[model samples]
Target: MCSGGFAKCLGVSLMPLAVVCVLCNILLFFPGGTTVDSEHITQQVWYFGGILGSGVLMIFPALVFLGLKNNDCCGCCGNESCGRRFAMLSSILFAGVGVMGAGYSVVVSAVAINHGPQCLTKNGTVMKWTYPFSEGDYLRDHSSWSVCLEPAGVVSWHLSLFSVLLVMGIIQMALCAVQVVNGLLGAICGDCCGCCGEVSM
Candidate 1:
């Protein structure tokens, strides 16, 4: 397939993943699918890893890739070949942005997972919002989840959603990395395999 077409496919795939990441981040705000005080919510949810890093940043590159296939400059520059090559070359920058954004999400998600969720916990006579589990201590032992006294089932909710963000971020990074190479190939090879016929005319 042509580089532009491949990029278009990558763009299409990224759109839904970005949406999913945004939704996952939003859900993180309401742990256990119930409303809670904003102060009680996990700190990483405030970082906007899925919303800003993966969702908004990724959309720019996806839109750029989607438009690459139809890019034409015959009327503007009287040189469709040069215009197409320039567009492809520019796409590499957007892909780098995507890579960085996704990487940010991955780092935040990993840290959140390690820290566990913020919830009301009983410390002697007082109930306070705190991280009840040590780094990754609760993941292996379901019984340890009882330490979080309020925001019922928050431990499971936190682990599941953050895990999704981590996996999705990794996938987004890989896709953007692939686009960097695809953009380079399109720049060098003139965007499409059959463009030689049009150039000859």
Candidate 2:
């Protein structure tokens, strides 16, 4: 593997990861769709936007990495050619997407906390999944206006999963930044400094 091979690996890995995260986030909100809650709509939009943005941002770099792997050409900078420059630019874009995704994940986690539908039990009582409120309060506030019956635990679980994915995205972004710096070093120092040159990672 060349110096930017690690970056190529990361870009390849991130594409599928991003796809999974996007699906999970969308599924997380689908259960709540029956309710006309504006908050829920906003949450879904943010999740979709951020996750999809990250995934889309990764494609160009991933393609560039593939080109570098197959071309076997050397450009002005090093043995890898213009692929390094393209990788740097794409990594920077992915980093921005990752930051936005992270912030959006925080919002999703906050909104999802104790937020669920009010359900009626066989015992003639209603309950909702809300925090800071006791079971007694949950049983009492079962408003008739609520249309859906969803388990709070499931929604919470998906939200947690999505949050974890977002954290992973952030880490990938950092790795991309590291790759950018590595490429920059290689461009500046060339073969003089082995740290950034065409060496195996």
Candidate 3:
């Protein structure tokens, strides 16, 4: 298959993944489907991992990849093949950007999962927003989840959403990595079967 077609397929697959990351991040702001003060939310949610990292950053690369197929240039010093190669080469930079973004999201999601969620918990007869779990301790002990007095099941909510983000981030990273290789191959070989223009009979 032509490199452009392969890139287009990758781009199509990335779009939905990016959307899912954004949606998951947004939902993280509202634990257990209930709204709370912004300050009470987990700190990691503020990092905008899924929003900026996975969602926005991934969108750029996806769009670039999608357009690569139609980026057939005809008037570049009368070197259409050279122009196509350059276009593919340029996509490598975008793929690198995507890798970085996804990596950021993965890091943030992992940290958030480890730190657990911030929720109202009783401390010596006083209630305040605090992280009840220490470094993923709550993941093993479900009974400890009672520490979070408000937001109702916030621990589970946080874990689920952040886990989704982590998985999606990893997937995004893998896809971008693949694009890096694809871009390199496209640059080295140019588009296959006269992908830039119709073959002369």
Which is the better candidate, 1 or 3, if ranked by lDDT?
A: 1
The TM-score of predicted model 1 comes to 0.92
Off-target runs (Cα >4 Å) in candidate 3 are 71-81, 193-201
Give model 2's TM-score versus the native structure: 0.55
TM-scores for all candidates?
A: 0.92, 0.55, 0.91
Is 2 or 3 the stronger prediction by TM-score?
3
For all candidates in order, the CA lDDT equals 0.90, 0.47, 0.89
Instruction: Compare the candidates by lDDT and give the number of the best one.
Output: 1
lDDT of 3 by residue, 23-88 (tens): 999999999889999899899999999999999999999999999888543323336545777878
Best by TM-score: 1
**Which tens-of-lDDT digit does each residue in 97-168 have in candidate 2?**
554554454455444433433232232474533233222333345452233334334333434555555565
Candidate 1 clashing pairs?
A: none
For model 1, residues 14-117, the per-residue Cα lDDT tens digits are: 99999999999999999999999899999999999999989999999999989887754232233554677788899999999999999999999999999999
lDDT of 2 at 20: 65
Worst 10 residues of 3 by lDDT: 72-81
Measured on C-alpha atoms, candidate 1 has an lDDT of: 0.90
Q: Candidate 2: worst 10 consecutive residues by lDDT?
A: 114-123
Candidate 1 ranges with C-alpha deviation above 4 Å:
72-81, 197-201
